[model samples]
Every structure is written in structure tokens, then in C-alpha cells.
Target chain A: MNAEAAQPYRLVVVSGGTSDPSSTRMLADRIADRVASLAEARDEKVAVSVIDLRELANEIATALVSQLMGPKMTRAIELLGAADAIVASAPVYKAAPSGLFSSFFHVLDNDLLIAKPVVLAATAGTARHALVVDEQMRSLFAYLRTMTVPTSVFAATEDWNSRELGERIDRAAVELLLLVESGFAEKVRTESWKSYQHEYGSAGGTELDIDLSTDLMRLATGGSAAPRRKP
Target chain B: MQFGVFSVSDITRDPVSGTTPSEAERIDAIVKIAVKAEEVGLDVFAIGEHHNPPFFSSSPTTLLAHIAALTERLIVTTATTLITTNDPVRLAEEYAMLQHLSKGRMDLMLGRGNTAPVYPWFGQDIRQGLPLALENYNLLHRLWREDVVDWEGEFRTPLQGFTSTPRPLDDTPPFVWHGSIRTPEIAEQAAFYGNGFFANHIFWPSSHSKRLIDFYRRRFEHYGHGTQAQAVVGLGGQAYIAKRSQDAVKEFRPYFDEAPVYGNGPSMEEFTKGTPLTVGSPQEVIDKTLTFQETFGDYQRQLFLLDHAGMPLGMVLDQLELLGGEVVPVLRKELAARRDPGAAEAPTHASLVAAKYGDAPARQPRPNANRGDNVTGGSPYQDGDAQAEYPSLG
Candidate 1:
């Protein structure tokens, strides 16, 4: 079935920094490289797709208002959809994730991130906002129902030079690699897909059971019967 | 194969003229567009139901009923009657009355209306939009089929022995098409009930439409309606046609660029290339629309968004003339030529009545004059036709 070509893991990196060479994307790239190395060490062929939010700033804002994604933006969303693990790093602005970064995710299908393993990382100008990675990004991913690794990498301008930042990156990358190999995201979608609530009409992933006892189906058929099975 | 136009009735300023039509003028124009659809030899005219500003079609049945009266052969319908906010009992009564008035030239598409605020305005929760649609449609489906129905549901008040008035024409409920931009479960609901599944094929790319319609078609087969080819499917298309492709684009680009729905997102060329939207010559529209049949596999209905984005009434009529005259006739002949013989035709009042009765005399339910008995017993109809009636159903 062409199994070799289908990488065992797809690690997608979402960099939310507006600046081209910002520390946020650097933090994301460092973690992504570590995750790739760790997956290779474990003999897992992981393909990575990086989506830079800076490139999609206008498209994201337009999609927020227009509800339609242009081709480039749509492809980026598709990559996120196919990812087993995500390295999501956002620059903290006003003690929260960048609006553009959050807007990009807001435009995505709600069920797209469910059960996806994410390595949350954030870069701030000061150490006081370092906790924003967990406080903001983790909770945001939590709302998306994505599983975040315990070790969230937070890099401030000063902390970028510290040994703790590199260790945290390695720790988060190792956790994501473990998760991607576990295949929990695909497993849950394949197994318990109907348990989640999709954005009512977003055409998420699974066909739901229409109860036979529901007044319409009962009236349509004149009695309660078994739910229609998926073919 | 049925071809027609569905209007969102958006009251947008004409980008070229820098003028906007008044609500009254726009409503008048919407009716004119429907009449023009008929004159162009189209099969259907569906209007969307919207409850907000800049969009005028608040009561689609009312407008559709008027269109039904004005036109002879055109089958009038809702692009989607909101299944979420509207009361199921009211839906049953109003649509049935419209059915009688239109003399059976009516059917409808159901959707969980997209607007978020209308939900709260109607005393419903936006969070429970899907459930509201599920439960409300459940009740509405029963009220039309069963004359006296004791119904209980989560969304609204339970009814004990409630009879929706002016029972469906010939006791046949209007046919329904479940219109979904994305929901596979709604597609499942359509498949489970053997109704039509319509994809709004304009906004999204063809791949999106293909995925959703393909799932619906597969499930329609699973539920034993027929083979996948025989599933009743409808697709929404948007076109701005002229004799020459360049002229069409030249005229439509400004409107497309200023379009409230999808403007400012993708370029007109890119949007048209990615989605079912074709702003080109009649020949271009024909070739592009024909690919939809190839992609989605012989769908039953093809409705276009012809009147949105403030295209003037004369221009809309001209496009319809081009569509109905040049494109649809060719499409009808071509699609019909390649149509799967086993595929179901689009449902209509006549077809549904025929399906309900094969060469057998159709029922004409005549209620007895009520004796102060509070309710008529046994069968309310004097003719008492229970031969095809469902038995002991609850």
C-alpha cells in the first residue's frame, strides 16, 4: 500500500512571529529540528511542513471576514490537518498570543486540531510574560481540544541565551516525538470520531448516527428502527 | 437535470454605479429575477431566507408563493428554509399552505441558517444550532406526514394530537433538499431520509464540494435509497455570462471585487478557478458546469447564484437569458445525454405524488364537518383512505 512513502509522522510547525527573523520562529525552528532529530533517532521517518503566519497575515484577516481561504492559506490548513504533531510558537503581544496567529487557527475547522499533539512555545520581550506560553497558547489549544506536551518552551530575549531554553526545547521536542510515534490523533479520529463536536457544518471528519427514535425519522418510516450504518 | 437560480437577496450597492436599490426596489427586482428565470425556460427559482440587514429575504415562503402565482411552469422553492430558528409547527403549516396556493409547484431545501445572531433573536441557542435543526426538522417532517400527531421534542413544546392545518396537497408533503456547505451529518440525515443533498458549490473549491457530495452519495447508497449514482444530489453554481469571455470578466470583476461575501479574499480569477464560480462566456460556463457532473457524479439539480453582489435587474435578466438560452439548454441536453438511467430525477410535486401512488388513484383527504366533538375520530377524512397510510406509527 505504498506504506514507506507515507511518513509515520507529520510534524507541522506554525510560527506566529510577524518579523522575518524573529525569536518566536527561531524558537519554533529549533524545536522542530530537535523533534526531527529525535524522530530519526527513533527510526521514524517524519515529514515536516512549516506554516509561517507572517506570510498569511492578509489572507488570515480576509478569511476571518470572508469565510473563504485563498489557495495558499487553504494548503497551509491542509498541512495542519495532516499533521500528527504540531510545533506551534507564537510571539506574546500584550500578555497573549498574537491576534494574527490566533486568527489563523480561528479560521481552521474546529475539529482539525482535536487530539493533535502540540509542542507549545512562545517568545516574549521579557521574562514576566514567559508564562503566556502555557497561560495563552496551551489554553487556546486546549479549547481546540489538542493535546499539549507538558514541557512548554518559553524564550525571552535574555532567556534565549540561557541553557534552560535549549533543554526545554529538547524536552518538548522529545515529548512531541513520543506522541507522534504513538499516533493518538489518528487513532482517536479513526476510533472515536463521533464523540467530538465539529463546527456544526464544517464537515469535520465522521458521519454521525441519526437516532431512529428522533421524531422525523420515526415519522418518515412510521416507527423506530436501527440507525443507518455508514457504508 | 434541473437548472435554475437561487438569490441571497443581498442589498449591496452596485459597485459600478455607486447606487444601491431600496428594500422595496430590491424585493421587486428579486421577483423580476424569478419571472425572468421562468421566461428563460429554467426549471426552478429558489430564494434564500435571511433575517438580517443588507440581506432582504426574511420570509422566503411568502416571496416564493408570490413567484409561484406569477409564473406558470417554474418550480419555486427556498434556497434553504432555516431549520434552526424557525418553529417546526409553523414551518409545516406555512409550507403546506404555500403548497396549496402554488398548486403543488413548490418544494424546499433545509439548512441550519448560518447567521449567528438570528439564533438568539428567535429564542434559540447558537451553540445548539445542529440540535435545533435536528429536532425541529424532526417535528416538521412528522406534522406534514401525519394529520394528527402527538409529538414531543427537545427544541419546542410537545404537541398532543396537534393537527397542522391545510394538510399537504393530495396529502403529499413537499419534497425536501438538505443544503449543506460542509456538514457530513446533514448529508447523512439527507441520505438516511432519502432526500436530496445540495452542496453550496460556489464559495468552496470543487474538491470541497466533491468530498461532501461524494460522502452523501455513498451514504445514500448505504441507506438503500439506490446505488451511489442514484442518490438525489444538487449543487450550487455562480456564473456571470456574456457572449464573449473577456466582456463577462470585465463587467463582473468590479462586482466580484466588491462582493460582500467573498470579495477581498481571493482574486476573481483565482476564486473562479478554484470554485464553481464562472465569470465568463456562455461557452465557458457550459464547459465548467459540465465538469461538475463529472466531478460530483450526475447530480439532480444545478442552481446558480445569479442575482447577488448588486448586479442590476436588467443585467441579471440578461445573464439568465444567456444561461437559460445558451448554457442550460445545452447543459440539459448534454447532461441528459450522459445521465445515468438509474439516477433519480430531481423531485417535484408531480413526481413525488406519482412516487406516492403508482397508477393508483392518489388520496384526496376530505375532512368531515366537525361536530363539536373537539376532534374527528377514526380517520378525519370522509373518504378515509388508509390503504397506503402508515399503520400504528409513533
Candidate 2:
């Protein structure tokens, strides 16, 4: 076991459902519960935290327009920054994930979730939109460089009652549990963080490392950007 | 501490009046505004540069030189002169002339402009903005200090034995303040040169500005310029003050709602709470401005964004009265009392000249007769060392 394996794994759930008792949040919670019980069966502890996008709807819109982070939005970023793994669920509108879900991720720093494990799940009214999870949502997390599990959970009205839905959730839960147990995210951050591109104050304001030895930094300190002339 | 007012030179429509001022009218009004700033005893008046319509002051030095001629004891400056697109050679020449015209009563802050299209208009790529700003400033720094420069850089053509005319007022370069919202490299550049770092403390939360300012202070000390406490810092503030807090809020709400940069976004109350914008009575403005010292340490200058959002000249003049007459006097006393003993004073022409030449006379550079070629040759100035070597043309 690694140093991180001694502590309870922190699993964060982000739900982009808009209504009370939303199916999107329910799907996320079901996956989170399955992951928790699966970890417990292996004699490991799991701590789960939920980020309801409905609560942050206004804040997300405000951030989209003004680049200002509200208190709730700031807290949500803090939780995600500390999370070991994430379960992201959204209600499909038209043929894609809800704007609230996409906007929330859009406001996050590009490097915030580097190498972090995630379980992408989505709910739609029809089976026709089932591919939204893998096609659209996965690409967004991919751009963020998250380590999304191979098994993505998708639920339509019909699938919610089908037994295979639960089986897929179980498969995703175990995949995430194994990834979290391996400490891939922690290792990448600890060992290879400098290899990734980062902006100053990015990664939820935690990426503050500045490399002062670059060519631009040399120019900043009065050295010329041009090649030195031969004597 | 120095107290001043800065404008973005935005010709916004008055949401309350439902009218927009003509560019000519706004231009005339800004001159009146700067005159009133000094009339009411404010120390500085700054104007911003923009190339687009609905923004008038594309030529900051032209406008500032006029303002300096109109008012006495009021230092005129740019809120930010673009360092990315404008050639460093032109900036060195024009600002030196302005320094001479104003008799060392002018200084400027540098910023990479936000408008992307403006870059291509001047044969630049916005993607290269940061490097361009850093490199151009590197050249501009040499032009004012060194009489003859032989330079090569990435963005601009190389300079050979080039001398920028007018050489700065009494051989003193106008003090510079680097304005940045988030870029640490900008702060590093500012600290590397011992220049002031000005945070546009109006748009973002104070924490953002605090992080940048703290980094600047550390690097300033690292560069051995001074102790962290003695690094010069400037903050931008926004306020709408009245006899009562409620009246202030009521009067400013329409303008705040329809203003261009942040309109249709956060509510006035929310923005006021989140950023350094204060809409309250004179005492409240004074109280909130004082907290800036606590947050960023004792700093040198505080500039307020007073005349934007289509605010009429009459209303802006009233704000200047409440600011210069009521708010600034109290703030001056309070900030002076709270300042750290080791903190540096705001840079001025007299002080910089005194620092450069303690008892000796300042160097007055007189150019040798032109050789008709572009080259000024080595020892271009009469006072320059004659023994300096140059390749023989033989």
C-alpha cells in the first residue's frame, strides 16, 4: 500500500440535474453508493461529496460572463481540487450534456483534473441519446486530461428499470475503485506535474510554481531574446 | 501616498440620460475633468489609450501634453500605454517629448491590451503579446538611459547606434508602473526593474490583486532593489460617493447596470461586495479605501476610475469634489498615519532627479552634427566619451 492508500479515498460527485429528485443526480448517487460499498468490501474506506450543479447554476452563469467565482463555485472547485476521484452526471438536452455541466467544467482550470479518475454517467429521455455520455461528455473530460474509466454508465427511462444498468454501474464502480487504489492521480501530480502545461494561479489557484529559467524569464531579467553577437 | 483619478476614455452611453456623448464632446470634457482634478487638489490625472471607436484617447501623449499645459501641479499620465503593439522606439521618443513638455510631470503604466484585433492592425500577433511586451519594454528602457543603442531583438528590427531624441527630462526617465491582473511574469518584469506594480483592483476580487502584489514585493526584494515593504505598489479603485450611502447607490445603479465591460452580468451590490468598487457615503468610501493598505501593505499610489460608464461631466466633477475635497483629504491623513516607516514614497520628477544627481548637475546631451546617414556613430552625444572605439570606415 502507498502512503495515500492508508487514508479514505475522497470521491466527489458532480450532478448537473436541474430538478428535485433528479434522475441525473440519482444516477450519480447510485454509482457513488456502489463505489463506496465496493471499496468497503475490499476493507477500504470511501468519503463521498456531492456538487449539485442546480445550486451553482447562477454562479456558473455569472462566472461564464464575468470570470468571477462566487463563494459556492469557489468551494466546489476546492472540493474537486482535493478529490481523488469524481463521478460526473448530467441530464441530456437536445443531443448533448446540459449547458450547466459543460459551463461548470469550462470555468475550471484546464490542468485541475490532470490524471484524476472520473466516471461519466448521463440520463436522457430516449435511447437515441445514449451515446452522449461517451461521445460528448467523455471528450470534455478528455480535454481536461482526466483518466475516465472505460465503462461509462448511461440511463434512459427504460434502462433505469433494466438490470443491466446496475451491472454497468458496478463495472464502472470497480474500475474507478481500482484506479483510485492504484493512486495514479496522486502519483502523476507528485511526480510529473511540471510536465503539464499550466497557467499561473491555475488548478483552482494551487498551480503557483513559476519556472524562472525559461527564455522568456531571461528576457524579463534584462537579457536579450536575440542570439549573442560574435566578438 | 499619492491620490489620483484615471479614465479608460470610454464614450459609453448614459443609461440614465439615454444619450451618448459625441467623440468631440467627450474629448473636450476629459480636458475639463483633468483641469478640475488639479483644481480640487488631486495630485494626478491619467488617461487610457484605445484605438477603437467609442474610445477617444488613441493618442495619450498628445492628450496628456495638452492637459499638462492646461493645469499646474497636476501630474498627467497614462492609465496604461500599450507596450505590445506600439513600437518601443516611438514610445521612447513620444513619451520623452511629453516628459520634457510636462517638465517631468508625467509617467506611464504599461499593459498588454486586451483587444486581439488591435494587434493585427499594427502588424503584431496577440499570441506573442507577453513576449512582445517584455521585449519592447527592454528596448524602451535602454533608449531613455543609453545615448546610443545597438540592439537586436525578436519582435522589432535591430537598432544600430540609435539615439532617441530629447533624452528624457533632465536625463530622468519617467517612472513606470506595470499594470497586470494575473500574469506573474508581468510582476516579475516589474520587480526585475524596480518599477512600480499597479493592480487594476477594480474588476477582480482583492485576493487576486493581493497574490500578484505579494509576488511582486518578494521578487523586488530578491532583485535587491529594496526591502519588500519598500517596493512601490499602486492600486486602482472605483467609487460613487454621496452624503448618504443609499443615495450613492441609487445614483450610480443605472450607469453600473449598463456599463460596457461588466453590464448585464453581476448586480451592482454583488460587484461592489466582490470587488474594490464602493458605492457609499464619503466616510464609507474613506473606510473601504483604508482597508486596501491593510490588504496590500502600505503602498505608494491609489488611482480611482471616476469618469467612465457615460457619467456626465457635471456628475463626474461632483465625484471629484467629494473625492478630492472630502474623501482624499481624510484618506491622505489616515494612510500617512498607517504607513510603515520603511515604505517608499511615490516616485516624482524632483525626487528621481535628486536621487540620480545628488549635488552634480544633470547631464544635458547635445548631439554631434548629423552625418546624413541613419547611423549616429559611437560617441553620438557631445558629452559622451570621445575615446570610445568605433570601426574605422577606411
DockQ of 1: 0.23
> Tens digits of per-residue lDDT for model 2 on B48-78?
9889988998999999999999988998988
Q: Give the TM-score of candidate 1.
A: 0.85
The per-prediction CA RMSD against the true structure, in angstroms, equals 5.1, 1.8
Model 2: CA > 4 A from native: A1-6, A226-231, B369-375, B386-394
Candidate 2: C-alpha lDDT: 0.92
Tens-digit lDDT track of model 2 for A1-231? 556566889999999999999999999999999999999888788999999999998888888998678889999999999999999999999999999999999999999999999999999999999999999999999999999999999999999989999999999999999999888999999999999999988999998888888878888888865567685
For model 1, fnat equals: 0.16
Task: Tell me the lDDT of candidate 1.
Answer: 0.83
lDDT of 2 at B35: 97
TM-score of 2: 0.97
